[model samples]
Target: MLEGKVAIITGAGGGIGRDIALLMAQQGAKVLVNDVGASLGGEGRNAGPAQSVVTEIETAGGVAAANTDSVADASNAKRIVQNALDAFGRVDIVVNNAGILRDRFFHKMSDDEWDAVLKVHLYGSYYVSRAAAEPMKAQASGAFVNMTSTSGLIGNLAQANYSAAKLGIAGLSKSIALDLDKFGVRSNCIAPFAWSRMISSIKVDSDEQAARVEKIKQMTPAKIAPLAVFLASDSARDVNGQIFAVRNNEIFLMSQPRPVRSVQRSEGWTPQSIAEHAIPALRPSFHSLDVSADVFSWDPV
Candidate 1:
């Protein structure tokens, strides 16, 4: 579906990114696999992960190049895009799948923990996408598939940093779709339900949580690649600024933020009036403090 196209899949060393890179190449996109083999907490680096994925792609009769640049830095991110251009001539797709997790309760989270997570998942997506925007605009066509998470869309325990970063990515993607649509560049987000290195970080403290993890394991990283490939292909031209979720075999067009209920007064209301009248009317529309797992209550069949 992506014949002659060139793609950059960040964090393409392993997990969901690796699967996406392989599928993109298999579908005929010359892929630039970028990774800075860091641990889940965004510490240290090795080139083995990226180089290995590149080798895997090449061995499977696909075109790919390995890049060990960290997307967390703006200059390195630009270098990543430039490398893709140098390798494949013109850029066509960018999958912002690079991420790290530093799980901690809000009260106990450290500044470094917050900054490190945001720098990798949120800023990294922005840095890479900003660099690729110009090339896509110049060519008058491109697609971006960003990885978001239910942790953000719904909620998650002890993941303030991660949820915030993922939610910011959703907004960034929407802004990109709006800003680049005129130039024929499209952007979308994927909230994937998959068992990967990222998900392996989940803290399973209860029997129920363990069972949930087992169910999640059934939805492997491979299940996510098809949707990523589709969103980054010409086939999804009409689909822009949309959020999607992939579970085992199910694909969902997730809902975006929209006003569900409203209360208005012709005359300006005071706080007291709002408290007395609006609060009662709007209470039913208010959302509960439910986490991702709570919202996804049923197992994916």
Candidate 2:
């Protein structure tokens, strides 16, 4: 589907990103597999993971190059794109999947933890996308597949930082789709329910939780690659700025924020009027404070 294209996939060392890189290459795209090789907490780095994936690709008769660069840094992001250009001469697809987890309750979260997640997920996405925007504009065609999360789309406990960043990525993807439409650039997001290093961190304290974890385990990271490949290819040129979720073999077109209910007064709302009139009028439509798991309660199919 992506014949002759050059794709840069950040976080391609393992998990979802690794699978996407492999699939992209198999589809005839020359891939730049970028991974800082950071641990789950965003500490330490090694080149082995990225290099190993590249070797796997080449051994399978696909084209790929390994890059160990931090997407959290603006300069390194540009160089990542540059590395792709140097390898294959043009940029066609970008999958912003690089991320780290630093889970802590909101009240107990530290400044560094917050900053670290935002820097790698939200800011990293922006920096890389911004750097690639010009090149894609010049070429008059491009696609972006950003990694969002249900944690942000719905809610999650003790992931204030991650939820904020993932939700920000959704908005960022929409903004990019709107801003770059004229340049023929498309951006979309995926909220994957896959079992990876990130999801493996979920604290399970009961038998019920353990069963839920087993269900999640069936939804492997590989399940996410096909949708990402489609979004990054011309096949989805008409599908831009949409959010999707994948669970096992099921794929969902998730809804974006839109007005479901509204209440108005000709004289405009007052504190007293809002309490008596508007609150009651809109009460039925108010969303619950449910977490991601609550909303995605059905067993993975």
Candidate 3:
């Protein structure tokens, strides 16, 4: 389905990015493997993983190239996309799967820790997508799939920064999809629950963590790759501005708010009036806007 396409995959060295890149290439897309080889916490690195993937793809008779540029830097982001264009004649798909985790409780979170995660997960995607959008716009056809997580959709202790960035990715996806639709470019997001090197050696501090890890362990990162492949394929030409959660073999279409309930005041509006009349009925449903629906009816299906 991805035949003859050129795809740029950030953080393609390993984990979900690696899986997505290989899957797209196996489906016949020439892939650009971009990875800075940063550690799980976005610190330290080696270039081995990035180069290794390129070699593997080449050995398998697939067209692929390795780029060690950091996605968080705007210039490096453009350089990575340009590298793909230089290697292949054109660019068709971009998968922003590069991310890092800096976990800490809200009270104890350091400014550096918060900034680091935001830079990678939010700004990194922004930089790369901005760079890729130009080529996509010119081609009048392209797909952009950003990696998000359930932690962001919901909430997870010690992951405030990560969650915020992931949620921001969803917002970015929707906005970009709206803007790029005129150019026939699609933007979407994936909230995947999968196992990867980042969490392979992680130590669970409690039974809750153990249970959470066990639940996610059942969902391999490879299972999530097919959705990405589909999104980048021609079959998804009409599928844009959507967010999907991939776990195990199941693909869950996430929900968003769409003005489902707007209880206008029969009485004069005031904080006191809202608290008295609206609070009871609206509180439960208001917060439920975060995630509750088959798929958001914001626009079409």
Residue 173, candidate 2: alpha-carbon lDDT = 98
Could you give candidate 1's per-residue lDDT for residues 1-301 as a string of tens digits?
A: 9999999999999999999999999999999999999998888999999999999999999999999999999999999999999998999999999999999999999999999999999999999999999999999999999999999999999999999999999999999999999999999999999999988988889999999999999999999999999998899999999999998999998999999999999997999999999999999999999999898889887
Better of 1 and 3 by TM-score: 1
> lDDT tens digits, residues 170-278, model 3?
9999999999999999999998767888667457989966866676676677898999999999999999999998767777898875875656776667998788877
Superposition error at 11 for model 3 (Å): 0.9
Residue-level lDDT of model 2, residues 148-215, one tens digit each, is 99999999999999999999999999999999998899999999989898989889989988998999
lDDT of 3 at 267: 60
Model 2 stretches with alpha carbons more than 4 Å out: none
RMSD of each: 0.7, 0.7, 4.4
Cα error, candidate 2, residue 32 (Å): 0.3
Best by lDDT: 1
Which ten-residue region of model 2 has the weakest summed lDDT?
261-270
Clashes of 2: 0
Model 1: weakest 10-residue lDDT segment is 292-301
- TM-scores, all models, native as reference: 0.99, 0.99, 0.92
What does candidate 1 score on TM? Answer: 0.99
lDDT for model 2, please: 0.94
Q: Rank the candidates by lDDT, best first.
A: 1, 2, 3
